[model samples]
Target: MWFRNLLVYRLTQDISFDAERLEAALAGKPARPCASQELTTYGFVAPFGKGEDAPLVHASQDFLLIAARKEERLLPSSVVKDALKEKVEEIETAQMRKVYKKEREQLKDEIIQAFLPRAFIRRSQTFAAIAPKLGLILVNSASTRRAEDLLSTLREALGSLPVRPLSVKVAPSATLTDWVKAQQAAPDFTVLDECELRDTHEDGGVVRCKRQDLTSDEIQLHLSTGKQVTQLALAWQDKLSFVLDDKLVIKRLRFEDLLTEQAEQDGGDDALAQQDASFTLMMLTFSEFLPALFEALGGEEIPQGI
Candidate 1:
């Protein structure tokens, strides 16, 4: 499956286990529906959506694909508020006494338990690619919180995960601002027409531009006033395009037609074959793109062993 956003993490040490070992560890915590009174549940799931019989881990070359599924009961706060209000009103009117905070809390708890079984279930999945050779884990989530949740689940399943968020020696904001100021990017990368600029001062202003000339005088004026680029769109060697933010998160990632066309030709009509082809192509591209990106950002900061 294609990932639209990435929250990258670095492995502090080599992964000792193979794909089979990882699969067995995950199988111990397979995803299941939330219980009647449980608000949420989380566990590993089949990455290919090929039913329960499918493997939870999908391996290809040096990369491994895994997915985490979370199921949560949908109990709206508005409904609870309305129900609580009505119950409190009824109690107060019938008993001729105000409903105290303690009693109201107990009532709320009872109401929630009563409604939880009837609440609808919402399920979602997060996919991650673990590259053992590269020592990277790329989570397909825009939110850091969600990415961390997946990592926590993985760590629980594996007993331990020696990894941390990817960091660079150089500040990404500085590099991005410099690129825009010079109207040039590092080799193999082309600056695109979208960026987010923010003043460095506390409570300062922010400017977002889209589909406009980044090298124009208007953009230059903002830079002159001490505004720094926090996010910028970039294309890499005609293979991939994505927005790079100050935190080094990759967002709005898109594979160029050149790469996708090749995958399609190789995959034919089989859905599983297509996914495998696309994933292989994507990982191969990242093998090149990520190193170049690190170099451009002044290289990655290696983490100490756990």
Candidate 2:
């Protein structure tokens, strides 16, 4: 499946596991429903949602697709507070004494335990593509915290995951600002119409533009006033489009018709086959795109000693 957002990381070491080994490792902490007293539970799940018997790791063309599922009991704080208040009032009235802080704390815990089983379960999944050859792992998460949770779980399952957030020698904000100011981008990258500009000064103002000419005088005016581009929309080689932010996170990723059409032609009628085809195409495309992107940003910042 196509990832909507990319939180890219660079692997520091090579992974040598095959499908079976990786599957067994993931199964060690397979996803399970939250217990009656548990607020949240997280573990690896079948990437294709093909049922419990399906492998948790879906390997294709030396690329591994994995998913981490998190289930949390939805117990709203307001509901808990109202219930606790009622219990506290009831105890005070029936016992003919004011409830103490220690007793109230105990009652709150009891209330939460009683509500846990009846609470609705909110479930979400984070998907990641691990490219061993390219030494990269791209997570489908917009939030860095959520992406780190998935990575932590993966590390626990596999015993180790040597990786760090992808960084480049040049700051992304600087490069983005330069692109908009010059009204030009690196080869194979075209600047789009949407961007977020912010003043370089602390506590300064921010301006967001959508569906407007980024090269126009209006945008130029903002830049002229000491604003820098924090985020910019870009199209890559006519095959992919996305918004790149100062932190190097890619958001609102879309595979263009050029790539999707190729996937459709190669993908067979089978659902699994289609998914596999799409995954392969996406990984291959990123393999090429990321290098060009890094080169455009001055080059990848290799960690010391590696």
Candidate 3:
């Protein structure tokens, strides 16, 4: 099985200057007694936004570190490819700034033109010392699942499933009912339940839910739409119960009386997009880290709007 942990983090305190140092560490090998290795430096090529003439102001100092290894390669191509793709997206957005000022913000023409057929984008950066290197990486003091551990756990769990999954959309929403909704439609289906793993105190957090109690109005919303699902149970304070549906979880849920032994299962891929406008890496580790960090920074969580 192939996997690596992506330690996405958000910095706690603001880093003011364009960073040339950390990149070295991420991309370079360790320093020798007589000579120093080159520092790895990642760059924020450009920024773009809808209806903006010039690129929206963006911090150039921020950085991202992707820790990944393939089911095959020494360095996970997933990380390298993901990084390269991001750079290209940034470049395209930067190149398309002018068209955005016009009435149509999509810049359809730019999208068509940005990728030159013969003139492919060749991206390679070289700088001496200080960037995220392939060896000895440091995370922003916040990481729970590395790519390897997470993917392995997922693979084994999937193997044990009684049946295989077919794809569609909308498996679940709201983290509370993840278990009950993962099983449905032998060949194809979607359920409505979400996973809210934001680390914080809420009146009705999953902590309050009885895993055996998958009979909420939210869970039944599926039956209303001609779908069937087996609700997985959750312990009040358990690790993320994604796939694998840990039998231990069932055991505990049984003890807590949360499982209904006679239900079916159904669920699938989640909708994920880069979380925020800024690229502060540390807080990105936790779903709630950003919101909490902002408050600590004296900024309230403002709802996005015009």
- C-alpha RMSD between model 1 and the true structure: 1.2
Error of 2 at 86 (Å): 2.0
Worst 10 residues of 1 by lDDT: 297-306
Error of 2 at 140 (Å): 1.1
The numbered model that scores best in TM-score is 1
Error of 1 at 267 (Å): 1.2
The lDDT of each candidate is 0.93, 0.92, 0.26
**Which scores higher on TM-score, 1 or 3?**
1
Candidate 3, residue 108: Cα displacement in angstroms equals 61
**For every model shown, what is its TM-score relative to the native structure?**
0.97, 0.96, 0.20
User: Against the hidden true structure, what lDDT does model 3 obtain?
Assistant: 0.26
lDDT of 2 by residue, 202-250 (tens): 8999999999899899999999898999999999987999999999999
The reply for model 2, stretches above 4 Å from the true place, is none
- Model 3 off-target regions past 4 Å? 1-17, 30-306
Measured by TM-score, how close is model 2 to the native structure? 0.96
For model 1, how does the per-residue alpha-carbon lDDT over 1-306 read when each residue is reduced to its tens digit? 678998889888787758999999999888899999999999999988577689998999889999998999999999999999999999999999999999999999999999999999999999999998899999998899989989998999999998899999999999999999999999999999999999999999999999989999999999999999999999999898999999999999999899999999888999999999999899888888998999999999875535
